[model samples]
Target: MNREAFYKLTYGLYLVSSLRGEKKNGFVSNAVFQVTSNPPQIAVVCNKDNFTSQLIKDSKLFSISVLKKDANPKLFGLFGFKTGATVDKFESVKHITAKTGAPIVVEESLAWFDCELINTFDVGTHNIFVGQIIDSDLLDSESEPFLYSYYRDVKKGKAPKNAPTFIANK
Candidate 1:
């Protein structure tokens, strides 16, 4: 069977942020999705070893910033492509502290969601964190969401090994 077909599936790029005390980190992910309406729930898939995962475990809080199409690629390089253990991910970016105390990027984002972890499911290499939406807001009226297809087909972006969408080409 051909695995290349998996690349055609559509998704959206997002930055998932988490914080615990002074520890804070974020990374680009396409696995974020809305799971419910009433009470409003959302899920985020995080690599087991990601620093943000540790933060989420300790704080039980997170925020998602829907990136606009025009967001700088450098932002992804800092927040997505690199590990937050060595460097400060928020130093190079502009953000605000949510009521949940999670750092959220408000710059060039179409929208944002503040979430409280309700439950979690361990899925081998990743843990799926389902959270109850505590708050949400539209940051910009005319901003266009950055599509995963645009990252691959248009901008030629590749999924990181930890990304849920990363399937080995065997």
Candidate 2:
């Protein structure tokens, strides 16, 4: 069986942000999805070791920022390639604090969601945080959402090792 077949799965690029006390961090992820509509819930998967994960676990809150199709590549590098533990992820990025206290990047986001973590499932190397949407709104209806396939096929972006869909470098 070819592992490349897994690439057929559909995904969308997102920015998952959280706050722990006064500290804030966020990271790029492709494993965000809506799980239910009745209760308005969403799920986001993140590597256990990611700084953003720790913040989510501690704060029990998070915000999802849907990256726009024409988003700056530097924004990806800043959030994905760099470690928030060593640097301030929000230093240069323009964002607003949600009612949940989680920051939402308004710069490249087409929409944003503020959530309250309702449940957590431990998956190997990562945890799936199920959040009940507390608030959400469209930032820019004109801007198209950035899809994972677009990031790979058009932007030529590769997933980092910590990503759920990361294809190991051979």
Candidate 3:
């Protein structure tokens, strides 16, 4: 099977964040999708080793910042490349705590969602966290959402090893 076929699937770039007590963390992710509309449910796939994943599991809540097309690459570098285990990602970033106590990244975000985790599924190396939308807001109606394709083609971004889209060296 050709793994390249998966590239055809569209995805949006986002910052998925959660708080473990007073400690907050976030990471860049692309494997997020709306699973239901009636009850307003969304699912985000996170690697088991990710610090943000543990925070979500502990807090049972998360926030999603829909990144804008023009978002700064440095923000992605900070969250995607650096480990939150050592770096204080939120120290310099401008964000606010959502109603669910999840950190919501404000800069260069077109929209945001605060979610209450409803269910979780272990999928090998990743966990799928399904959440009910508790709160949502549009930050920039005019800006277009950042797409995974754009990240790769325009920004020359590559998915981290833990990312669902990551293709290992063969």
Candidate 4:
């Protein structure tokens, strides 16, 4: 199969956050989607090795902040490129803890979602978690929500090694 053709599959960039004990962790992700609407469900794919993934497993909750066009690329680089085990991802970032006590990103967010994990499917290198929406709100109206295509074509963003889109031969 031509995996690059999967590039046709669109995604929106987001700051996905969760907590374990007193430790909060977040990372950049584009693999999020709505699995259902009646009960309002979403599926988020995360690498099993990610610290944020570990936090999600422990906390059983997560927050997704949809990134805006004006959002700082540095924030994305920090969350997407740098590993939280080596550095504090939230040190320089401004955030607010939600009703779920999950941190939500305020910088350049178009919308946000706080979810409670309901199910999990182990998929080798990645784990797919399905959750029910606990909290959700829109942030911006005038500006557009930045698309993954824009991140690549406009910002020249490169897919990280752990990203689902990472291609072995490019």
Worst 10-residue stretch by lDDT in candidate 3? 161-170
Each model's lDDT comes to 0.89, 0.93, 0.92, 0.87
Instruction: State how far residue 96 of model 4 sits from its true place (Å).
Output: 1.1
Candidate 3: stretches off by over 4 Å: none
Candidate structures ordered by lDDT, highest first: 2, 3, 1, 4
Every model's TM-score = 0.95, 0.97, 0.97, 0.95
lDDT of 2 by residue, 28-102 (tens): 999999999999999999999898999999999999999999699988999998878999999999999999989
Q: Candidate 4's C-alpha lDDT?
A: 0.87
How should the candidates be ordered by TM-score, best one leading? Answer: 2, 3, 1, 4
Candidate 1 lDDT tens digits, 20-131:
7887899899999999999799999999988899999889999999999958998778877899999899987889888898999987688999999999999999999999
Candidate 4's TM-score reads 0.95
Q: What clash pairs does model 2 have?
A: none
TM-score of predicted structure 1: 0.95
Give the better candidate number (2 or 4) by TM-score. 2
Clashes of 4: 0
Where does model 2 exceed 4 Å of error? Answer: none
Residue pairs clashing, model 1: none
